[model samples]
Target chain A: MKRILARISYDGSGFKGYQKQPDARSVQQEMERALAKIHKETSWRSTSSGRTDAGVHALRQPVHFDTTLDIPEARWARALNSVLPKDIFVHECREVDSSFHARYDAVGKEYLYRMTCGEDYSVFKRHFEHQLREIPDRRLMQQAAGYMLGTHNFSSLSSPRTAVVDKVRTMYAIDVLKEGNSWTLRFVGSGFLYQMVRVMTGTLLEVGFRHRRPDTIPEMIAFEKRSAAGKTAPGEGLYLSQVFYEEAALQKHLKTIKKP
Target chain B: MKRILARISYDGSGFKGYQKQPDARSVQQEMERALAKIHKETSWRSTSSGRTDAGVHALRQPVHFDTTLDIPEARWARALNSVLPKDIFVHECREVDSSFHARYDAVGKEYLYRMTCGEDYSVFKRHFEHQLREIPDRRLMQQAAGYMLGTHNFSSLSSPRTAVVDKVRTMYAIDVLKEGNSWTLRFVGSGFLYQMVRVMTGTLLEVGFRHRRPDTIPEMIAFEKRSAAGKTAPGEGLYLSQVFYEEAALQKHLKTIKKP
Candidate 1:
């Protein structure tokens, strides 16, 4: 059997989440269903790089599965897309080493959180962007994000439901991009805890609102408590932009991404 | 009661069509439902510039209604938007002259049709753009469009179900914009028969595909038969971009619209 790694994209509006669950519509369930049809009587289990929450979109999610079918790389994408729903799409597929685990082999990840504030927010993007109740100060948000760079115990910025004890993670980059009334916060890290990106964004927004000071971020991270951070941003605004396997490929892939 | 004019926008994916039907969901039904709640005892009837077919979107569709309520122009949009679904939106509102009628007073209209050819089309735009099976020659398409400029009998370019006796209409502008793998065609005309824009786009695309010679366009217009032209493009790719009242406003408004 050959292991196939595929780059996928999906609109999360119609899905419950990325994970498969009985009686719930999900991206994984739909993908595996397509795979099952192509594999004849055999069942093919797929593995993803990460699990995104409901309403969270993905532009380039990587997934791997083993199959004995001798389909061409380009034909695999075409075949899979034909059976998959319009909301989910397979962009590219390639044969990979059997030892390459989609989750464990991932060296880094990148997430993008979109936000719109004030009265001029886009009506078209209501499902895709977080609409802030009040306009926040951009400069203040930028200063607060700077504190989140590098290695730190980000337990305060993760969900309390996260059971893993190792909270220390390296944040390689944090960028705050501003355009018109909308802004996007991009995060590149070695790995993120559950809801880490959302909580970090929410905390920085609180700083922008002047409810919390930029210097308070350090103490919040040091406290290692979930209560130390602000409210978590909505899942609809978050996106799993990329999953990096090779450390050298992170910067090269980032340059290709454009502003929303 | 004052006649209120509003510019509306909607994503047509969830809607059956623009007109009110007995059972199916429509944009007009949703708008009127919101208006009925605000009017209390009295019912306000709305009239649109044109009836768009199923799955057809609108960027700036002008609608007018007579209302007894004394709500401010700004508040009118806000009030309606609050009651409407996320797919439909009220962008701008104004209290127009009492004699103004949405359909009768309209002098001209603009329609935009989007298309993408070959394999590299955007996956996210499946619901919005027409994905052509084969790549078309753009230069040949442009040459065919030139024949469609100025006043012509467009009976061959509209649906056969059209009841209008006079099919002659003046075309002010016909622009074909190419960007990457996708292309957009914009049409500004005095008036269009039902499905005229979509049919025209299909005919031009057929020219681009080399299925029909560019010189045959004038003969198609001369024939004045529905079978003389190419097939009608799908409604999903069509948009009612603008409805013009004042003759001078057409050029001014056209300049403001950006490419898809």
Candidate 2:
């Protein structure tokens, strides 16, 4: 058996979410359906690096699956893209070791949130950005984002649906960039809880708008309550940009696996 | 009655064209419907800067209409946007002279054509760009574009739907800009005939791909037949970026009309 890894990108507007539900359309179901056509099997299963909510786009989503077919790794992307919908694209594909777990072996993740501050909404970019009438203070938002760095109990930054008890996570970086009328917030972290990025963005925007003080971020984190954070930003502005993993670990595992 | 001039932007994917058709949905139809709601009257007419083909987007499409309503010029945008669909926006609205015509008063126009050459097609930008597997030679395309500049009879570049005998037009500039995997061509000209920009882009792309010679552009113009030019590029990749007019001329005409 050969294990295949694929890097995918999708416009999440048409999908319910990344995960599969009985009646709803999902990214995973569409991918699995396409895979079934290629493998000629109905029982094939695949795993993603992580799941994204509905209306959340992805630039690079990693996934892995076990296959019995012996096709060239480069050709896999072309094959999958031919059958997949126009909104979903398989960018890269490669043969990987059986020990490489798409979810468990992942090191970090990066997410981006885009907001446009202008009175007139851009019809072209409406699907990709959250539009506001007033421009937020970038310096204040950046100061608030600084407090979110390092390790903390991010329970206040997650959704109420998050049932995980251990809410501690390390944030590597939080960057706020403003260009023209657009503001982009980038978050790099070990892992994220359900709707954590959206909540954090919402809290930062409140600080930018002077509704909350920047110094209050630490207290919010300490509260460890979902109610302490601001409202969750809309899903349309969120994007799963990248998934990070150690190259050394991948190389180590590759030595033990047979070539396809 | 006051003549109102407005700058509009729209995602043309939802529109059949800029002109009103019997059974098809058009940008003019939507704008007129919104105007009818504001005026509490069913019959309203509008004139656009020019007609854009089906699936052709616009960043700044100038339009004018006669209204008896006494609302402030600045408030017109806000009022229209509140009722217009999400895909269409009135960017700017102002009172204009009765002599100012949306079509006849225009001095020049600017069009943008986007092409992406890469193995992976971006799902988010798929609707706005034309994708190709092979990267075209930018220098070759630029060279061919140079031949298109200056006053020329563009009859060969126009579609058969163009019934006008006088096809002479002056091309101010044709800029070919390449960044990463995306190539953008900007055409600034006195005016364009039916499918003129698309045919010019297609011919330039043929030159870029080594399918045609750069020097053939002048020959194509000399032929004065539509069949002599290359294929017309897809409407989805084209954008009516800007329409240019003399501010002095507008001001001169404004002095003759009574202010609202």
Q: Which candidate is the best by DockQ?
A: 2
- Fnat of each prediction? 0.34, 0.84
lDDT of 1: 0.87
**lDDT of candidate 1 at residue B242, scale 0 to 100:** 83
Candidate 2's error at B86, in angstroms?
1.7
| Model 2 chain A lDDT-worst window of ten | A251-260
Candidate 1 residue pairs that clash: none
Clashing pairs in 2: none
Q: Cα miss at B71, model 1 (Å)? A: 1.5
Q: Report the error of model 1 at residue B133, Å.
A: 6.9
**What lDDT is reached at residue B67 by model 1?**
86
Instruction: Give every candidate's TM-score on chain A.
Output: 0.94, 0.93
Task: For candidate 1, write residues B4-50 as lDDT tens digits.
Answer: 99889888877889999988999999989888988874445899998
CA lDDT of A253 in candidate 2? 38
